[model samples]
Each structure stands twice: as structure tokens, then as C-alpha cells.
Target: MKKIALLSFLMVFLFSCGQQAKKSETKSEDTPKEVVVMSVDQVLEQASDLAEKEIAVKGTVMHVCQQGGQRCFLMGSNEDITIRVEAGEKIGAFSQEQMGSELEITGVLKEVLTDADAHNPGAEHGEAEHEEDAETQDAHKVLAENQAAAERVFFIEGVTVKEL
Candidate 1:
């Protein structure tokens, strides 16, 4: 009888241990993972794959849109790259004072498709219209100059922003 009682207690202890382990597993699964913080250049380089993903990034505020104070531009530490970040409703508008200040921003990275015509309007028509008119030519020139601009353009939908 004593042996049977000991065995039953051990079984209960084992079962409770298993239950606790399962609970811990579920708790860990429910918790959100930490976001990796990156610089503007790193985010830009990985923009295609990182699009629509939430991430944390640090950069110096280069410019803030004055109209309604809704958006601001951030530049990498080396000043090699810049990215746009729109302020979230929770955080409200970004003040002009934030410009030139290093900021740590947590947000969702987004990619906006550039206008197809802006990239190559003539190509869609074919080689027959090789000689684009002055206006068209001017537009093409502007587009060519800003070719990298579109590819590098990424907006961070700001979740939080703080000076660092």
C-alpha cells in the first residue's frame, strides 16, 4: 500500500510538471518577439524583403514636413541614406525641433509602387516613339536622375519615436 501511494504521488508530480511546461510554452508563444533595430541604410538595403514588416531603426531627423507636422525624414549615421517616417496618431506630430536630433523609431516599413509611366513611358509605346517630345524628354530626364530615388523610397509608419 505504501509503495502504491508513493507511485501515485510521483505520477501526480510528473503530470503537474508537464502541465507547467506546456503552460510556459504557450506563454512564450503568446509574447511578441523583440524587433531588431537597424540604421537607415540597412533598412533601405533590405527594404524589398522588409516591406510591411515592423522594425526599429535609429537615425538623425533630417527634415520634418511642416504641413500638419505629420512626417519627418531620417538620415543614417554616416549620412549616406535617408528614409521617411510618418508620425502615428498615438505619437502625434513631430516638431521641427526634432530635426537634426538622433531618434530611435519603431515602425512598420512600407514600400510604395512608383508610377509606371514615371519609370518608362516611352517603353510602353515601343521604339517607334524613340524621339520623345521636349516635355516627355524632360520628364524622362527627371525620372532617370531620380531613378534610385524611387527604389530607395521607404516609409516607416511610426509606432513610437524617441530621442536617442
Candidate 2:
């Protein structure tokens, strides 16, 4: 009789433990994920790791590509860092008026590889080897300046935008 009672108690305790573990697992699954907000510079610095990941960023719109209205450049509060934000299919064009306005944008980070790099992967070395004339040198200097403006250039495929 004592053995039967102990066995029964052990079975009930084991079953309750299993039930608690299942409940905790369910609770974990139901927990909401924390959202991370980043500045334009942080995103630029982490672009290589964050590429293809969705993130929220805040910045001031510095320029919008007026011709297509599909893309805009955003500058952080520091002014030294800039990132490109591209309108998602559903969001449509970004207006010129949006420039100078502070905005919170949520999107996926994407790398934009230039045509030359995309087509001929080895072309970068060839371009670096070419001798530059005075005019070509000036152009190369401008390109280098642009490249130095940010650690890494990335385009955000905007999922949502709100002016702040």
C-alpha cells in the first residue's frame, strides 16, 4: 500500500513538471520581440552584418531623387553619416517635400552593387590601375570623397515611414 501511494505521488509530480515545462515553452513563444531603433551611422557601420535584416532607423531626409522619387538620402543628427532609403513597392514615391523633415523609417538593409562590380567582379582592380588625366583625377577625387562620407553605403527597402 505504501509503495502504491509513493508511486502515485511520483507519477503526479512528474506529470505536473511536464505540464509546467510545456506552459513555459508556450509563454516564451507568445512573448513579443523587442524592436531595436538605430541611427543612420549605426546602420552604416553595421551594414555588412545587418544586410537583409529589418530594422528601424531615424534620420533627417537630406535629398530625394526627384527624377524617380523612388529613393532618398537620410542624414543622422551628426550630419556626417548618410544612408539611402528606397521606397518599397507598396509605399510608392518619396516626395521632395520630405527633404529636411525628420523621419522614423523601418526597412530591410540592402547592398547596392554598382553595375561594373555586378557584371565584372574583377573590374575594380582594373579601374584602380588606370592612369588618370587632370579631369579624370578630379572625377576620381569626387568619387572618393563620396565614398569616404560613410563607412558603408546601404539602401533601405522601406516598409514604413513616419515624419517626426
Candidate 3:
């Protein structure tokens, strides 16, 4: 009887240890992945898939926001593709001289709708909507122009930038 009890205890302990290891495995899965560095073209190609994920992208600083330096546009190596990088809490702003410089930026990818009401198909485009006043008509025209621009824009919320 004593031997049987010892064997049963060992079996229970072993089973519980196995379950504990499985729990640890699940915890690891819930953890975030390590950051990976990518180029502008690679990021743009997989933009949708990489949304909300932290990544590092290397590009040339094409344009930095002159108003507040809060945002900068990064161009690909070939100069055809561009990705916008926005200053995050850690990154206060980008300097003007950063333009024309190659940089490796680490940040989370973000996407924003340029115009939330982009081409509202359900809304009627009748003259009644724009006939309120001349100002209203001008506003409508501006809104139309804005809508015709990029419907959605993808950018990176920059965290760190390293000139290379």
C-alpha cells in the first residue's frame, strides 16, 4: 500500500509539472515579438500585415515638418517609395537638418484615414447639400479636393531615429 501511494504521488506530481510547463508556453506566446529592421519598400509592401507591430525601417529623410518638426517623411533607397514617420512621446521632434540624411527609425506602424467620410456612396451629391451659401459651397469644393487625395495614409509613429 505504501509503494502504491508513493507511485500515485509521483504520477500526480509529474502530471502537474507538465501542466505548469504548458502554461509557461502559453505565456510566451502572449508576449510581444522582438523588433525587426526593414527597409522602406519592404515595409510598404507588408504595411497592412505589420500594422500595430513594432519595427525598424531605414530610409532617407525626405521632408521634415517645418512647423513643429513633429513629423518627417522617409524616402526609400530608390526614391520612389516614401513612408511618413511621426514623433512619438519619446521622440520630441525631428530637426530640419535631418532631411537628406539616411536614418534608421524604430517605431510602431500606424495608419490613419485622410478623410473619414471619403467618398460617401450613400450620401446624395445633389445641389441642395451645397447651396447653403457661398462659403458652404467653397467648403464643399475644398472637401471634394481633399477627398480626391489619398484616401488613407500609412505612417510610422517614430520612437527612435539613428542617422546612417
Measured by TM-score, the strongest candidate is 1
Per-residue lDDT tens digits of candidate 2, residues 105-154? 89899987653224442355474566658996676666656555634447
lDDT of 2 at 53: 94
The C-alpha RMSD in Å for every predicted model, in order, reads 6.1, 7.1, 5.8
For model 2 the local lDDT of residue 50 reads 95
Tell me the tens digit of each residue's lDDT in model 1 across 1-164: 99999999999999999999999999999998988899898998898899999999999998999897799989986656789898979769999989889999998998776773346765667868466589987877787777756554679999998898
Per-residue lDDT, model 3, residue 17, is: 100
Q: Model 3, 1-164: lDDT tens per residue? A: 99999999999999999999999999999997777789899999999799888899998898999998999999886766899899978989999999999899999898876553454423757445343577866776787777766445689998888999
Which scores higher on lDDT, 2 or 3?
3
**Ranking according to lDDT, highest score first:** 1, 3, 2
lDDT of each: 0.86, 0.82, 0.85
- Pairs of colliding residues, candidate 1: none
Better of 1 and 2 by lDDT: 1
lDDT at position 90, candidate 3? 90
Give the number of colliding residue pairs in candidate 3. Answer: 0
The whole-model C-alpha lDDT of candidate 2 against the native structure comes to 0.82
Candidates in order, TM-scores: namely 0.69, 0.58, 0.58
> Residue 131's C-alpha lDDT in candidate 1?
68
lDDT of 1 at 32: 86
Error of 1 at 77 (Å): 3.8
